[model samples]
Target: MPPSLPPRRKSNTGVIVTVTLVAVLAVVGALTTVLVVMDDKKSNSVADSGYNYESQAPTPTRTYDPGPSSEAITPTQPPSAASSTPRATTRTTTTSTPSGPRPVLKTKDNPLFLGENGTNVVTCNLPKWQSTPTAAQAFFTAALPCLEAAWQPVMQRANLPYQRPKLVFPSGKRWSSGCGDVTEGEAAAFYCPPDGAIYMPFEGLNVQANKNMIGSYLSVFAHEFGHHIQALSGAMKAAYQQAYEVGPDTAAGLEISRREELQAQCFSGMWFAAAWNGKGSITDTVVRDMLEDGYQRGDDNNPSAPRDHGKRQNYGAWQKQGYEKNRTYQCNTYLAPASSVS
Candidate 1:
């Protein structure tokens, strides 16, 4: 009562202050709404699935060709060649011979070597698969030489060194590799970097083709060799290492896997080009069949599939890009825009 002077008169200034506060809050709310909408739009624009088109392509006609028979069959007994011949203990590197398609063994005594802890090489004894085992080894052996001839010069031109990997045709329930033990069902063609070799059980190829025998078998070897080319190129290590460093969910991981797979496809295309150039037997029909077979094997959606190579459309487009252009640069799937190919 002593200090309560005249009640202070509320002025228009008070109302102005209240109005200004309300206006400021409204402006802040509006700005927040705009920001949230923009963020949503940006997120929606980045695609997670990328491009997939295997469903739209037409089915390809299947074909087969059994090559001429050879007498140099796989040995049924454990390899005696290495046992009888004195061998060098230290690892030896050898250059592929320049003239023809023949298996280039480090030492003539052992065209094939067992992994460090592996048992000696024994001839495949699986019933009904006897003759094919030798043929498969011979075919792969020949193919490796061809691949070396084709890729070495290309690699040298790119300022990279070429390291030839060994080819192992194991004919049993399991085979040991520098990487680890490869079981029967797990035995489609694969390149084990640790051992620097390509491995395949003859039966896996037979099963993949439903015993069709030729087209698919040749294509699988080519594809596996394609991976070997990648290993030699230093591209595979770079890609996989980058993916490992970055989490797989990140952009880098996806790009790395895409690049590795696509480059292998391109290498396979180069092989086709070489075949066309050398033998002159590679017809348009043959090319089409190869593409179709590759597409089927690479289909990613199939649950029981052995490899996550790619879908049919993806494989076909990449193969077409490599063959039609016939240039490694053209098959640069990692750098190319998604809209540029299927």
Candidate 2:
């Protein structure tokens, strides 16, 4: 091929140099543009892959004691559910975003339901369970800090006060607190708002009546912690006052109690979801044991028992909802229908 020449000109040398410079500049600019586009795409790819729940660490398989109890022991009562008139009122929080201030959603109106999603708590290494008060006490003491850490962000986001409640492992079958005297049979474990302490009597756990799995116990503790969440968020006091005004033992009052209880169950499930396969000790098998125990914790089958907690199906249903969904707003039982909570 023959190279083409420019038209005859008086300053051909200068024109040739100018044309060569322009061509070189064009190549350099094109290369720069390609590099910039490639770099931008690389940055976007990294940003898009940010911390997904599904990308968490694999839960290590742990050996569980398969010895099943004759009957599952129900998580009987949250002391706050009892007939107590609370003077405190329901507290609401406001949310802000780029657009403008947003009022809480009607369905997830509770203050605790502010976060985008529930948190995966820090790695937790729980002590072995020997079915003794001392062992249980140690396990719970170690766990309280983790719970505090996990919920701290949510509370802060909601503009709610966050603090660790007192953890008390009562010794005897019958024990009394600022709330009232409670027997082992009445409440497996309870949260008392007066002293802001979680009461976990060894007898109340009924460790013998269930599989010896740590996650099962953790779920129970988390459920009671759910009550403390209610108390701190003013949900407990507000629900109590409403129930008291309508008579705590009446149908309406019981329905309110069921919503409170089931919501706690949902919260418990969220905790399990956060911890399972993401942190220490909580594995799929552990969650399985917990769910198996939880399925039987409902009050439906027992004729004599008060229907404060939902049916066994709904009982497990809400927990799985929290676990699978892993969102605080999704656990709102208050907005649920009478049939669903019932």
Candidate 3:
């Protein structure tokens, strides 16, 4: 060999540079992993539940029709009525607590969810229940003004459109309505959104089961009124559109129906709370009976019943929650988990 110019001096530069590059790469990779994890958590917080904390009305891309949705009652029949009308009365002013309660703007945004949890003590002096069809109509008619008294102010405060729902007492077992023709046994009562009418057929009320307990009938009527509230607040339209888009009989559609029905139950409880202990026949006994009736009206109570009205426990649970809380925010079924509604 020509003899190396000199023994090659050991150099740490290559080793040091290689180690530095490896360390830099490791740090960069760790940072990237951390960022990916944070982004995943942020994205899934609301998406997993399919809801958001936006306080805006639901936006529907197209018109939808919620056919004559029915609230079935106990299996029994009563007499028939040819006609009925809400008794006319002077408007009553409602007083609420100052600094109105704000709605819990969490899951679903609705106008009725916007107003104060009103504390207006209603004075509903109802007629005694009678088995005859005419007497039944008279009793229901008398209660109409009372219901209007209770809800008008609430609607006004919520900034929702308010109008007295039209009333009818069909005489036969089959009758036609704005929504469609309805068989007597199909439902005890139903609300027709197109015409804003509540069709209460005497034959469908199943009054024979609770002839003396007028509160039972009142609860039924109030549940229908709850649908009216949904209609006025745009909640009904939004829910119906979703169901229509996903096939009303599908699992998702049924879940949506449960939410609407359960909310109605809560609304009925609210009415009972407001009308309880008032200047009327609504006594402790009557309210208790109403609550019991709610407990019995769950889907699980009836075999062959569709699961659109929630299970037994949840059914009464929501009603009791509303009756005790007496706050609309407490009645937000849309915010509840799927398990709760199911």
Candidate 4:
């Protein structure tokens, strides 16, 4: 296939920007996330979980030790997951809420309900599958049009203004952009709201995941896009404020972070389902890989890691909850039982 003429640029003239910063909840490297103010005036750098962003470098100055207080992590429950069909599994309790205000979903009335048979399902027009950077870049190139068809209605339904986010897939062990450059393993893939773009370096999948399964890689892309959904919905701002109100690593703050991360998972599942059902290339095998990938990424899988994201069971459940159930309401971790969210 050949390239098409450039699409028109979207205007960000009067959209309000906030001082809050946030990112996908995980720890591969430094985990110091840089976020954008709601306004595009400038992007702000902040740690992924903690309030501030110290300088970033290829060499990690700080240990991944978020902190210590006997909230030692739970083990990663093995995923009995296979294909798109989900299985019921037991969940583990990991956090105890100290007496404080719990985080709430910012918008009670959102128009993001897309069920299995819902409207606006868009089939992806992906290029021939290959494990190379050029192939992956072309994959996203085709995927974005489908994304626009599937997600724009979600924003419009909520009566919020929407715009296409920027995209970049730099090739190297290190690169710098709207978000500061840290070295490899610090981040595999992440969304920076300030720059309004999704950053996907080649190593994100090729090295970090150590496997070249396209389905799993696409899930990462969709997850980051899910963050874009949050930024556009104002949910990111509310969650950031809530996290700041309570310390980011505290029990409350971690729960808020988990809910945020889990919601992103749910959103990823939602979009994937729509694309798959609408003649997308996600096969049953790809669905299995996606689950296995989610299982491995669970925070509880790593004992020394922070439980900023939920355990494997909950992580798998929330994703399945979105895919199997299809409704956004079912994906609301903020309003869920702490046990389910944990």
Give lDDT: candidate 3, residue 86.
Answer: 21
Ranking by lDDT: 3, 2, 4, 1
Better of 1 and 2 by lDDT: 2
- lDDT for position 260 in model 2: 72
Per-residue C-alpha lDDT of model 1 across residues 1-342, encoded as one tens digit per residue: 111111212223221100000000000000000000001111100001111111111111111111121111112233343354443233335454343222222211221221111111111121122236786677567556656665565554433456787877777755565655544433344556656666656644544333433434445555556666555554555455555578533655554444445445554555555454343334344444555444333223233322123333454345444443344444445554432221
Candidate 4 lDDT over 1-342, as tens digits, reads 111111222212211111111111221222222211010111111112211222322111111222211211211221121322221122345455333222223532233322212214566767766778887788887887777776777565444557898888878866676546745445556677667777776655543333446656666676667777777665666776777789777999778776766676666666655665555576555555554444334554345555566654555455544554444555556666677656
lDDT values for all models: 0.38, 0.50, 0.50, 0.50
In each prediction, how many residue pairs overlap at the backbone (N, C-alpha, C within less than 3 A)?
1, 0, 0, 5
lDDT per residue (tens digit) for residues 240-317 in model 2: 666667975699977777677667767666666556534477765666665654554454334455556555556556
| Per-model TM against the reference | 0.56, 0.68, 0.67, 0.67
lDDT, model 1, position 274: 49
Cα lDDT tens digits, model 3, 1-342, are 110111212223321100000000000000000000001111100000111112221110000111122222111121111221221223346444333333221225665554234424566888888877899899889988877776667766555567788888888766566666655434456666676776666765555555576766776677667767766666776777776679756999778876776676666666666676244676766666665554444444334545565654555556555555455655667766776666
